[model samples]
Target: MTPHEIGTTFYAYTAASSSVAHILDASKPATFSMVNAHKRLAILIHGFTSSHEDSHLQSIKTNMLHHSNGEVGTVIVVDWRHGASALALPPYLRAASNTQVVGHQVAHLVEELRKHHGVNPHNVYIVGHSLGAQSAGFAGRYALSTFHWKLGRITALDAAAPSFENHPGTFLTKNDAVFVDAIHTSASKDHNPLNGVFGFVHAFAHLDFYPNDGHNQPKCHNPLEIACHHEAALLYYDASLSAHNSCKFYGFSCHDWATFHAHHCTKHDAEMGYFADKIHASGVRFLATTEKYPFCH
Candidate 1:
């Protein structure tokens, strides 16, 4: 699809009580200036079949505002729902193909911020879920390759694994940004029937966090609860940003899950979610969580 054919909307949220404001029309360059250059910018991308209006996305935005203590300058929700609504293979393929184009468009907006508005690329953070996570990677890659700007960070919430597992460099990676952290909530398990229920099992970021083994989460007993597991990535991220978060998601550095489970791998420690501090670490890390609400604690 051409740049004109892709429909991406940017909604700006300034405060906790603030209603979403349409700040940018992707087709119109003039509207790009509506982005506030003074405040730190956060761009959120939702997964397939979801929109900027998604409840999970809203929760994260609200919590981020609350956690930042009004420090968060601006929150931009990237709506590419038109390309992500279809559940079939063809639509998924279309969405995947459009990822690069959307990334270019986003990079262009950031460039406008830098050139005209004086926004620092280091203050921009991109957060995405599932397929949206892959899109975030593309945006980071495009920003550096096309604009020579390295994004501050990219948070991938259980990036999709179905079509992207074998395609390296197609999804989020550590090199996409200065710091890339991923939360794998639902990955395929050996001899398990509910494989590929939500996320990719691979370690796609500098710090790949596997919460509750990153497969079937606690309290998720049925297949229908897949949303719970998939959405957990966002929940953890939201909690990590919330001031009320009392539980810290500490992970153990391990070569793999087997070594982690066998207690053979243990050398360094890492933190997960919004406040993750180990941006320099590489490889998979394991952590545990509660079965109920406020899963972090």
Candidate 2:
């Protein structure tokens, strides 16, 4: 389908979900008031076969607002399900190809967020998962080249491995934002065949994290459980946003899991995931997680 036919839509939510119920019309200054435009805004984009209503994105959306208290003003979920639905034949590839078009739509939406609503580029954060993460990269590229505006942050949760390995232009990268970070849950360096990699193997962001050594997670032992392991990144990130969460989301900056496991690279200052305290972070890090939910333990 063409980019225009994709009919990408944006839904905004505040602390009180029922209060402000207008679709984001960037042209209208009044639309800004509905979402308390002055505070920090987050835009979430889901991966293939998912929509704004999907639990994958909604969990984070629901948690962020509840956990952050009133600190975060608005959470916008981008609905490009028309381009990401299962009905699209050749499923994965079709959704993958549409990422570029959806990215263009996001780029325009992001530009309007500032121009019409008086929101600064620095106050915005774009978070995406899998194919959606790659699309977020495209948005960052378009925003920079077209508008010369740099976004504050972009968090890529396990960017899709297929269709984006060797193509720098089609995947999430550090250049996409001032602070671009990614979590690798189902893929690791070298991506050995026996490991069953699903997430993109490359460290494509400023802070690339390898949880559970970036291989199959605790319960995702079955080789064919691609979807299970891939969603681990999303699960870990959402848990980090919990208001009562302790400081258990930390990792050591190391060369690889070997270095971290061997008891070297002992410094574990920066908390990984949603509230990663260290912003000037560079290079990959390693951390351990449990086999079950509330994985931070």
Candidate 3:
């Protein structure tokens, strides 16, 4: 699908001034007069059938604003709703095909930010969920191949498994960024119907976190527990953004939950979400959370 047909839009926000926000028009890029070049730039991308206004994205935006604390930072929320909302038969498949267009567009935006606003590509942090996560990989790859830009970090929240699971060069991978991390909360084991899930059960990042066994999340009693499980990834991430360490999730390196529960993986190897240790955190990791909100233990 073409970009014009997809109709992507960008919304820029600076914590310092609500009045200085950038809006709907694609022709007018956000002016970073208040934001300095070296400051962190966060780009939050929502999944298929989701928009920039999704609660998960908004939570991160709010949390980022709090973390930056009126500092010189920019949080740009991408909305490709038109592309994500295809109404034809097999709509999800159609939406899945449009992710590449969105990714290239994001790369273009990053190039502009670096060229015109003095923003550093290495300072950019990409946050995306499901299909959005897949797009983030594409964005990272496009930036590197087309513009020679290596993004600093990319966090995939339970990256969608349907269209991307085993597809080479079509899914999120560790090579997408300098430090790519993934939080798998609702991973599926399609091999057994009883253990079906929504996310890929494979390790797709330099650091992969499978919280609560990566499926059957606690406190999920919905009729479709799978959905509740799928959503827990973002919520867990959102809670980890709190100022208080009580909610900040610290994970341990382990082969699996059984190994983690065996009391072998005791030391906290890395913190999840915003505070992730880009230095030491690598390979497969596991963590536990409460059955309710403020899940971190």
Give each prediction's root-mean-square deviation over alpha carbons. Answer: 2.8, 2.5, 2.5
Local distance difference test, each candidate: 0.77, 0.79, 0.79
Give the per-residue lDDT of model 3 (tens digit) for 218-245. 7687654446777788888788775435
1 or 3, which is superior by lDDT?
Answer: 3
Please give the ranking of all candidate structures by TM-score, highest first, separated by commas.
3, 2, 1
Error of 2 at 132 (Å): 0.8
Q: Which model, 2 or 3, shows the larger TM-score?
A: 3
Residue 28 CA displacement from its true place in model 2, Å? 4.8
Task: Tally clashes: model 2.
Answer: 0
lDDT accuracy of residue 167 in candidate 3? 83
Please give the TM-score that candidate 3 achieves against the real structure: 0.91
Q: Of models 1 and 2, which has the larger TM-score? A: 2
In candidate 1, which residue pairs get closer than 3 Å at backbone N, Cα or C atoms, i.e. clash? none
Worst 10 residues of 3 by lDDT: 18-27
lDDT of 3: 0.79
lDDT of 1 by residue, 95-160 (tens): 777777777777787887788678899889889998888888888888888899899888899887
Query: Could you tell me how far off, in angstroms, the CA of residue 257 lies in candidate 3 after the best superposition?
Result: 1.2
**Which candidate, 1 or 3, would have the higher TM-score against the true structure?**
3
Clashing pairs in 2: none
State each candidate's clash count: 0, 0, 1
Candidate 2 ranges beyond 4 A from true positions:
18-22, 27-29, 188-196, 222-224, 277-279
TM-score of each: 0.88, 0.91, 0.91
